[model samples]
Target chain A: MTRPALAQLVAVLVRPAAARELSLADWDLLVRVARVASLEGRLQATIEDAGMLPDVPPAPRRHLHAARVLADRQHAMVRWEVARIHEALAPEAIPVMLLKGAAYVMAGLPSAPGRQFSDVDILVPQARIQEAEQHLFVQGWVCEGYDAYDQRYYRQWMHELPPLTHMRRKSVLDVHHTILPPTARLHPDPALLWKAAVPLDGFPGMYVPGPADMVLHSATHLFHDGELENGLRDLADLDALLRHFAADDPHFWEHLTARSFEMDLARPLYYALRYGNELLQIPVPDSAFRALAVARPASPLRGLMDGLFRRGLKPHHWSCDGRLSGAARWLLYVRSHYLRMPLHLLAPHLMRKAIKDHRKAKREKSEP
Target chain B: MIAHEDLKARLRDAGLAIQVGPFVVRLRSQLDRIERSVALFYDRQLLPVDGAPFADFHVTLARSSGLRTVWRPQARFFLDGRSPFRPLPLAHAYPLFEWGLNWCIAQHAHDYLMVHAAVLERDGRALVMPGEPGSGKSTLTAALALSGWRLLSDEFALLSLETGKLVALPRPVSLKNAAIDLIRERHPRAIIGPASHDTSKGTVAHLKPPDSSIDRMHQQAGPAWLVFPRFSAGGSDRLQPLDRAEALLKLVGSSFNYSVVGGAGFEAAANLIEQSECLTLEYADLDASLGLLNAVAGGPA
Candidate 1:
């Protein structure tokens, strides 16, 4: 099959030098796809890192530059907010482990530059989660107006509290006690993660997960995520993290595989490795795959999941989608909820969401 | 460049790629009002889609689909297949397109430090008038463009971050409410489009940019003066010098992406203020305002 524009974007991301050969028309499509996937900044960073920005056509170069400027500004704001968050919780002595994007940025990881973030995610010990919330409340971060039912859902079943918005700055913060919901099928013990967390430089109370745990957390977050609008961007993060970590440590993959099994996150790691290798062509050791064999789904289910994820992982743009792409995304959304909670709880939650969405569409359509 | 009929056909089918100063926009619409608006306001900017291999923004102004099409029909604006705004009444299609295009530029064009202002150039120096709504900035811009100055833009002042120069993006000069008849009466030769009533901005029309302005849209000018214009009914025309510090703050406040661009935005705004004469103009009469502005531009009063 001929590579679609999305495949070309993936190729350019994997090998930034490939961008030199793209036609103006190709850049047009690539820019649209990358923007929709939220990977434009990442693409810009990779190309700039490769020192091939001058090789890009002027028309497309402006877009890359614009995205970079926005990302750089956001990175600065995130640093400031993280510092404020550290200050808020320092008195309580809460172990604030920066998760995902904030972690990548604070720790100065390869994936840090050019990543866009909507909120900061931090993990704390489950016992002190309320103490962390109380401290944040004193610092002027209030939970947004979620209805009673929604609040109950988050506080009871979800891993993170309802997102808190800073009154003055309007920035969002998500404080999680664990990587996954307490009720999730895959329970990665928070204790192991906390033990392995490393303190960020110049930040006494703040920490970032170690290299193996970081990769596992990213993989778990992506595979278990319900929304796939940024699926490709999240996968690129996994690819970047794996590539950087594996290259930095010779025995990285071995340690990651062992840790995934220990944390009961072997399945997400398997999917992350498979998709990263297949989609972006990130090099993965064959032994890693063999080690994850016990965590793979049954043959038929594996085939089905492959079909869904293959369609779901591309940019969520019309040009990148096939006939069943919509269905694949919907099925994965259901699968994500199922992974997060048991069927009894999942059914009601999805039904409520569907009803609310239907009402919203109706209201919009009826408006003049 | 393509003929009018070809532009309409392409707009109804694929899209019509038009050069709008520093950006290429692909506009697709089936509405007759949109076609007429483009013909009237952007006659010189249309480029053949095949020749223009890329577009910075792809927008569509279409009549709302389904039951709304028959009852209280609405026109929706979509940029790259996603609507950034709720649909307006079908009669307001042209204004919707204009507003949507402005949003596209303000949201994405971070390469330039954009301010909510009208800009015109005279003798290689730009006059930047930053104004809030009901401040008569657009009316003043229409007057200036009609007089002789090259219109840079009627809505945005795109300050290039790289050169610290004002880039021209001269499109239609939108005249709201009473300003519509005021311009038509003052400048009889000005080509103004049919007015759309009951818009969110109340009774809006567009004045076609002069051929001279569109012809030299690529020209970039250095900042010469920053004027904050306010319209006061029956008030005498007055121009007062504004402190550079206050001018910088107001300019930053009027900017669309000043905070997003951060330090560079501050530097660019400061440099523009530092190099230009900053003033506040409050006037009632168009002719008086024009004369005062001309004097500020160092031209005939």
Candidate 2:
């Protein structure tokens, strides 16, 4: 509960200028924690924005500078990949809605800088999803080797198709027809997102979700998704998105709150705003919290959820971990699956994964 | 600097922090083989700090846990409590540590434009020899390091991005296969570590770099020559001029983080080639190659 290193890391991230006052030893721990949390690039970007690069000590500066370089290169690659995706899908007249990191970067959002992600996620109409996949295949994007069960699980129950990797470039692209899985407890209509999508300038047939949808989708991906390894990074993304969008529009919070209720995603929105304010101290209006009162969990459950998320969201590093950090992360992982699917389907899927992992470990141990 | 006895004691208990060029690596090992190897090769660079508060890398060479310990004991290389490589045989602990350190630098140290080359310096000018495996690059590096040129690195040529200078990361030169015996014979005083056969790189041994190279580890040298060496069985000892543009492309292709560093990487490589005499050296013999390199360094042939 009392992680001084995590506290210091958060302080530096929220206000990078404070890095000027940090001791050499703090920089050492900060670099390690930031690297583990995948926030090194974000830290570098913020520090540079504050013009604190020259003031930082040489040893730590090299790491930050290196991360910035990597982030820039990754951003450029994402831009190029988006262009290629547009090229492949444009021929079919299918609209390519850029999602998450790729969307942030192409749309020139403030959340884009220093952000690195592995896959390019795109959304198309559910009716034309197959048609879009055909075009992508012709353009050298083939589905990665997912097992029969996983392939079936994705096609039948999941929102997105199994990830397609470009054969030559080795870049992954996730094609989705909706935001959440069909079996998930909440289904924010993909139609609403597509309707509100804004076209990207200079890129034909490519669009990014509207500001409210961007924040909602990021919040959903972070709080609803099973893997929280990059939990803190995703939270940071949410923080940046909210700050940027709120400043750009006078009624941004109102639009976000209304959209969350309109599309069955108020819970994630509520949690996002709550954590953004709690963890990163991003300002949220009292009216907005009052508006999402229906989505808030009961007092006892809410307290437990907060404890789990608070521990789960920190960088999964030993330096940042509490006594129950591992347990909290594991419980949240199970909770995510519970939210995504019915118990019958979830039980079998998890059991299969556990068995397969055990066999894999056994096989490895038997190797000479 | 810490004493050898102190270093060994620390290696067995907490860890021994040693300065390797620009980075401080804290090494720990319970195995006697690793302890002996560290005492032999890294005796000069051991810091007096009892467990350095801030290390660029924290690496451990420890015996692999589980059943492998009883039948075929193996050693694993861990960086920050996670092993990036599979466990090698217990006898191969020293070589594993060396390879592991190279992996750590190549993977994380994006501050510099890292080239897959051996670099040496003389008269304040660096000679970077970029070559593919089995090109006799390490063998040539060993020859030059013994013949008075201060060894910068045998694996990576750390090119500083801010300043177009070669930062010295002088460590033990890794010699493989026949080059081990070759270097041992050529330089009788050279302290070569115990060779571990059947490695992925074949038989591998590390030659302890001379004291002068370690002493001037902080010294940065302007890149004066870029030589791409290709070893042939009976090829002519020729040092022919290579086009700068072609050399730039080759350097980019041979770099570890060229694409990661992006535009800055391209500019750095181009600037290095532009400032240096770019050449392709093809030689069959070590002595003849050394003669040609010395001539290029403007030393007495």
Candidate 3:
């Protein structure tokens, strides 16, 4: 590649915030780095056919080095946060399951730092959130102001707890609560989550989502929430699972299907796998997608119509509403209200919520 | 009514114990572990510049997740109920604590300003970066940290309105693909861990805070400079001063709870923005950024 071309390639790979261009040399370097084989020759093979990396030297050592740096940082954050959680929940002694990133770190992957974690996800018994909060308070964690109405709406009606803020550290923790908000229409209780949780190797009180459940949750989070952008990573997670866990257990697929059905996340799982296989070359069985109704809508025209509205249409009935035009906007507002409370109690709930919020806003304004 | 003894029994059932500075908090019958962390343990949540409580309030809380299910905020603790749904995973607890606390203050205190940014110091001056994810905030923070700046925290840089001291809680520096490699090559001895791929955010790697940074973890620094650093793959390093108002707006936007703290948080943010020289930095090369930072870090007060 020429200097300008290489620079452009560098720009694409590095994504530096300021400069929008890369030199030819930069592109050559990036191409070399992309071809490195730290992961069983995966990178080498992945980039082999791409013209960008043709005849390039082995990928740079910086890739592994970068992975190590991220791993360390993530580990520190996870460990410190875990310890802090331990400190916060000392009273209830309810065992906290180190979900997602925490589990990833505890299982050992220090080179995989900067895993783009938005929040530290964890699962505690529903009975223990308040107890959990009390423990955190003494440790310099504070709660952001929400009117009593909003608080009640969330506490009484929502799935997880409202987000929590650490007073001194200021790191945000989303003290969830139930994976699915209580108000969710989905069937089945969250208590089953504990049944599927397996303890971490050395951490006595902590656990991880079972292999099957982990895949299911990832799919649900990705598809249920319109996670189209991070599809690559989400699929990568499943691939990582196949590579890491499938070898140990032959019943993985059966368990995965059973759990997906039990949790009502089968469709999402099927699509994740199907797209993953198509996009990233994850080799999931065709039978899986065939078993589920993931045929991308029988009518292509109908599918397009459905896709337009279903994707960004109204946010409330996002699951069921197929038509694009009508009370969609109003439905979303209504949905937020319902999300804030059950339908029958919507009117009174809104009244109470409004009063509470007014008072909170007043108080905050008056005090500081 | 559930007596104090009953509450104690419920707490015992849950099995919780916590130590905050010099206090040992035991939650026997309480539903809120975090409330006690602030109220019962600390006479006041915010310490003034003189190290005294900022206000007459003991503590406050605000929650958004469990309203319909766990809204029973009685002093009477119920430890026997099983949630109908799976609780959030434990990995989320720390961020939850931070967010919950923000709600409490934003809804209740209305007396402070909160800015979303990370604060680090070297030679007594603090570098504040306020940006969203994918903005290269964490990447820049890690690069600067490995280059010899004291990392206050990659996630938060807490400024106690009362004490005028920036609280240092050195945590992990999250890095993405290329930045991860850059840091590793830059600091071969750095400690890193497995990268969790395909998260809602993206591929993420966490870098352990440098041991030296952690060693000076408790040492607080005053606000010095607030610079929002953006990494451009191969862009030249540039740093330009920003006005207090614009800088404050940028910093507040990065804050997890600026509106909640209301004036106090705003004042705190405003004070820092005014006291510091604010700048926006865009760099492609760590070396170039490091050179720029070294000059800035070493320059006269």
Candidate 4:
């Protein structure tokens, strides 16, 4: 069974009044969920509303306030970085399309409020990505050290260039040509995403992905990537985006399913629909249910994926983790690497990482 | 609050849950040495169980035993079931916990403008000493805490955003190297913990905080004085006024979250410097330094 506390916390997040009252024990578990999921700052509005009633206490309120402050600071830093990136990319005329947290904040989406932004992401056209990188270099953004092997790997197989950091500010910028890596089975055309980009009014030369693409990108990043460290937070983002877009567009669900098919992202969309509805109770339209029925895995594979994702998406709390969770995470990790690279490259990379990690642990344990 | 004997028993069993200034620490250990330190140091703060399983940082301290036990047996600290750093010798267990507490604060408490400084209150005024390690901030704070001044904190100076004041977080003062002997000789009756030599920072011991400071822990002080202290042997005692802008920059540089707090940090810092008198003090003798401090506090020397 899903942890009862996890279920209650998710329910309360979706519909705040669902929590009639909570004991100190419940608040304790919620604190861990909020912290590990990085939702403390994002849940400020709900906390403020909840605090007005008798359900909240001073200790929990303090924790919520702390998170809200961090979110506010993060939002400020993101805005500052956007201005600098726009200055750098403006000269190249590279129609910057912000992705993820940067996009949510720029577009003034509900998901942006109190969101923790770690780094800024931008999308440029594939043809001019090199020129864009050169322009950023002149503006003091230097790419991280990539050896001959890594340089070849990224140039030939990756969708985005290696991440770059500013010399003075030390802020990170991830420039992308497409949402998914080129090595992936799904080959999404960048032109379609660019053509549908919505420009922000005040911020000239900057745009965010169109409504359907935004949700699809979130789904692909969460499910396809190698790391599930922030899986729960990413799921929360998908849930919020789906709900927001549905409210804005009457045909959002239909359009999203069609977009998924055209972009060759049906697998991630199916997973998103199934879990978003099951976990966060996002309103799934008839189109989504019908699409999931056709696109989802068959019975045995479906049962296995169900087991993996259900455990994988919850925050890493001991109370919620079962014996199977560790193995599930490991399997998912290997699966991501397999999906990320061909078997030849994948075998060596995993072996190297294992040996390096083992040596580091042993060295640390033996230190004075 | 739980009785001291009960608290020790709980530590031997499940763990001892204690609240230390805005954070709940759940500590578990089987070592008798760690238990004695717990009884001597954290006796006042352990909370009675209220049937809640809440803790911000869960850590375990265990003494290593084996062939290596004869020569420098060590104490290992674990947080969230992971060890971030190497073990210290067993005699360093008490300081290990102190440093661990600071680590947890630095990692999680991003809500406040945390400055690496010593803060103490006298005459309803706060004295903030922002300095680097081995800069006499801790030693000066210990002397002040023992001499009738209410100690706010010897390590972290938490600047609150909502109230726009300094929150008090008093703990045992850590004395290092020559300062350890200085405090022991000067105070005479000082409760100095057993010293552990050859630490990364040299020999270190802790001075137990005066009981009155712990009793008045809830009191937050308004900003009044900003003192940047540096101790030099055979040096003259001097406290010179510093420019407001310069003080703001130094405070920002010393802060843990000044950049993270964005505009709020800049504004709060400017407000603090504007209301307080900023000075830089250099001294060799503790008596001379305390006299200058009293003069600044409007007391006859």
Candidate 5:
């Protein structure tokens, strides 16, 4: 009864071989679990195996059907976006790289099939990011940034431009120069990422990170994320990427570990490897497992993180969210902020954000 | 299955699970008014096993926590255990629940192409009236439901993407402002709920479907007529045939999930247009309009 439904979802997904044997106690709880973990769409994609959903009854089947429809819609939408983004930036000739879900789709990886993308993320060379933004604006992808502070916040400190959305289509596009904010302690070299990028087959100007770098980016994005709203999904994506790249290259793990160190991202990678194996039951090479030990947070921090992450990463729902998970999420939220920027810059940013939220809330309340 | 008094008691005590359209919805609330309102509006609904699956949406209407409850006294809506929006006044809890259910369907239900329209059937053929606010869509639908037409839905016309048929989702028709009084006056026997004033959509109330419509809730209808009802105070009744291309364009605009449902939406919209003779209706006279709609549906005119 105390078993976390998130673990059960991941178990079914990553270890489908054992899924046929597992008896479901509450299909109702599992639906919430899948939604909270952002695995509803992924579950339908995962349940394509011949015997995957044989035990699931009708109610749960209905929920899964909705999820499948959503995934299909997202998949089609993502493809259309890539083509649109390509048309906008083609004249600039700036080597634009598709990131995350778009990259997964472009590469046709296992993770691509049912991945739901909120926004199209593209990496342009740092020097040309502004030029790329103007090109996009001309092509109708304009920023809806309402405030001076928000515009300044992104332009001054953040890694990406203010999110630009198509006027007609309304699909959001996030233009990024690097993975992390400039104000963060660890700013991965834009040149290094571009150097490792590989062009997509049919998309002429579009590219995706080389296999190892893609895994590293996924790990970095997940671990460093302020909110792990889709924590389980990201971990699942990493699991898929590791399994996928491992097929063609024996040294995929070796390169991933080395690249994490090279980019000063060993900390995130350590968490990714530990939780990826723990929650998802993904196979981690013994040598790679031992290699990450040096990179794990030292002693007291490691103990604190273990408790925080175990609760925080799981779905924040009645099925799994312990009373302590709320506190854990807050602590982790603060921890993410701490990692996002140095203390000098963090205070003002937090204050500005709080004020903006308060004013916005007031405006909404006053509306008829 | 729990009925009126028992369902209200259960909803007050624990929660109530009921089949709504193609999905099961479980709603929890401690408000006494919620119990009374639900009993009245959803009296005909079929209750499922308590705390069971097949619930596409789980919602709760509880008193807002903290000082706001002490001051203004509000009821907050929680969906899938998360409160997506802020609280509404306690008096408007019933209308809030109706709006919340509509939100649940509009947001999550993607298996069908959900059009923001009123749907009713007569003679095995469905009539779709896709309209914006102040278009007399719900009022016209309310009038028809009381007359002889089998009410499918007063909110959504759920077009099955696979079969191109309209699924019946019979629920109370939401009547706002003067229309509530109009419906009450016209249909004297209509099961109208109490009015909720000063909602986001102005004063609103729900009018329950007739017993006959409730009885045929499971019945499905084939697409036949699309009427875009436009209400005006002095406008004479008129029904002009709309071009297929323009009709499809208007339907796509009225659809809640046309963009998200993608190719399925396209196919369903195309199929609906092909099957139905579309029209733009401008009317002030109920009898005249009803006559026109009946004639178009090939029902007894």
Candidate 6:
């Protein structure tokens, strides 16, 4: 079947349309015009009342309704799950704070209502991750599989533990070893998370990451990899954070930058702020941003480094389509490896991982 | 001075400039006709709107005719929803929309190999089982996720392709008929949603993803084995290997839209099915089968 670009157009436009009010005829025309964009000829209107101006608003009511409905559902799920997590982890339990979508939900933005959460995110001490895993396992948490090779990469080589899944529940937990990948040379310590943790009322043992840390996590998570897919949502979160917490302290940027430097995530923090300001119209004072800017990569070399960094955040397919060369790929791979492990141990560690992945693949094949 | 119209009023007041595709739809003077046309395209009754401003964020709801009822993005879900969202949500009403949206925006970004499978992980590894309804996928998924393995999803298992993180969206594990009784008999503490009856499909009930799964919901998993499970009443207990092409096609078919993701989707699907050992399990015995899965999942660790 010849692929339908119409579907893509629809996917892109439908959401926009829902954002505003369009009479049936307007929507119909909008779709038609989009389809005919390539046509060299002038377009013709088919409606009888073409001359009459459509009273439809710029955006549709349905779009907002849909966004709100999804957002509300997301909030309820986050609220319910966060509360449940607090209850289950108990009083002596590790402090867990909501990250990304969960944080946005608590921040009380209308965007929170539409923000979709595929899985709930929380931060726990790297040491307690195993304990957390076991605790969750006994309580019906099932680990989704990774072979010995894959397992080693996550446990010993990478920053986080392999994601833990539940058999009965449709949720997955991303138990992190470090907030930033080990290779990024950034470690937003879990202890920092605990120190700044804010308690949810009535949930004696439960806590969310403090405001500063929460905002940092949001920036880091959104900007760590390129914030392509959820860019708008990230912008919304930054907007929310700026409006909510910044109001209390005009020096929120100081706390934010200090924490980023403390964690060595200033580069990612810079990128997030830059893109947020550029795309979402978030306002970061030039002076504040200047202090945190990642040192410029060498000219000519900078373009390569930028692409490499973006690729690291992108899907493998993106790298391929975007034309990441083998040499560049290898360099980027090396960077990722370094980010994942201590600088001293990265080489041999990655070599071991490559061998292990091969062995694991062979083992899986022999099984069935 | 003229008062600004409310959002609803604008729609009532605005003239239509109709266009569905290349052809412009004839604008109707009456509001009744516009509502009917919008409804006709929207299979499910619900329409979520942002009410002005962005205008592009609107989504129409649609449900799968077969197996479980999932509220999918009207355009994308039908093509992909059936294979990916099995045992579907108990009903397309609210929960489905809520859970489905999260699966799309947040979890899918990482190439986490989003599977229409339920996950149960123990030790550190997880077993991802993707399948269609009546395949006994959920019953087995529910049993394993609740038993010991972390419940990745009774509905959708989010596996990251990059970090190989299997993110869990443990909402409600939906069960039909005997499976509901089976789970109740097995785990008395299980919380279940109300059973919806005489649905165009069948009598359906939702088992809440175990409380702990909900509590520790952000668990990321690396996929070790990809199993397409089928629960037959008297079938032999065997986990057979599925070929890569077959496995990929089956997975893509089972996906909400293997096509939508295009090449990246293709690569993600290929990478996952390629790396993991593939299995098609058919069995009548739940307990014995779960034992097999546990052994398979827990073997090396």
Q: Which candidate ranks first by TM-score, i.e. highest?
A: 1
Tens-place lDDT per residue, model 2, A1-368, is 22566777788878887887887777767787888888988988888888888988887888887787788888999988988888888878998899999998988888878886778999999999999999999999999778898899899989989999999999999999999999999988888888899998988778999999998999899888766888788888988888899998999999899999998999988988888788888789998999999999999999999999988888888888879999999999889999999999989988988998899899997876
> DockQ score for model 2, please?
0.61
Chain B alone, TM-score, model 1: 0.98
lDDT of 3 at B190: 80
Q: Which regions of candidate 4 deviate over 4 angstroms? A: A1-3, A18-20, A49-55, A352-368, B1-5, B51-56, B62-91
Q: Report the Cα RMSD per candidate.
A: 1.5, 2.0, 24.6, 2.9, 2.4, 21.7
Off by over 4 Å in 6: A1-64, A107-111, A225-228, A293-338, A342-368, B1-301
List iRMS (one decimal) for every candidate: 0.9, 1.5, 23.6, 2.5, 2.6, 13.5
- In order, the candidates keep a fraction of the true contacts of 0.66, 0.49, 0.00, 0.46, 0.51, 0.06
Order the candidates by DockQ, highest first.
Answer: 1, 2, 4, 5, 6, 3
Q: Put down candidate 4 lDDT per residue, A72-109, tens digits, no spaces.
A: 77787788889888898887688899999999987888
Question: Which 10 residues in a row give candidate 4 chain B its minimum summed lDDT?
Answer: B47-56
Best of the candidates, DockQ:
1
Task: Compare candidates 2 and 5 on lDDT and give the better one.
Answer: 2
For each candidate, the DockQ is: 0.79, 0.61, 0.02, 0.51, 0.48, 0.04
Candidate 4 residues B180-241, lDDT tens each? 98888889997888887887778888887887777777878888999999888899999999
Query: lDDT tens digits, residues B2-106, model 1?
Result: 577887899988798888999999999999999988887787888856778888998999888887479788899998888988888999999998889899998
lDDT (Cα, 0-100) at B221 in candidate 2: 95
Q: Write the number of the candidate with greater DockQ, choosing between 2 and 5.
A: 2
- The pairs that clash in candidate 5 are none
Chain A alone, model 6, TM-score? 0.68
**What is candidate 2's lDDT per residue for B1-301, written digit by digit as tens?**
5666777788877688889999999898898998888888888888877445677888999899886489889999998677888999998998888889999998788888999999999999999999999999999999999989999999899999889899999788999999999888878999998988998899999999999999999999999999999988987899999988898889989999998988788888888988899999998988888899999889998
Tens-digit per-residue lDDT, B163-260, candidate 6: 64666655556687788888888899876655656544466677756556655655565667888887777777887888879988888776653433
Backbone steric clashes in candidate 6, count: 103
DockQ of 4: 0.51
Write candidate 6's Cα lDDT for A1-368 as tens digits: 11222232232322333313444434433432232231100011111123222333323222222233333445676677677666656654766655666656664533353455567777677777777777667766666777676787678655667877767766676766456765565666666678877876666655667767776777766555333334444555666566667777888878888877776667667766765665445678886677775533446965776665444332222212245544455675565455555766767766776787898788964652
- Tell me how many clashing residue pairs each candidate has: 0, 0, 167, 0, 0, 103
Stretches of candidate 1 exceeding 4 Å from the true structure: A1-3, A358-368
Residue B216 of model 3, lDDT score: 70
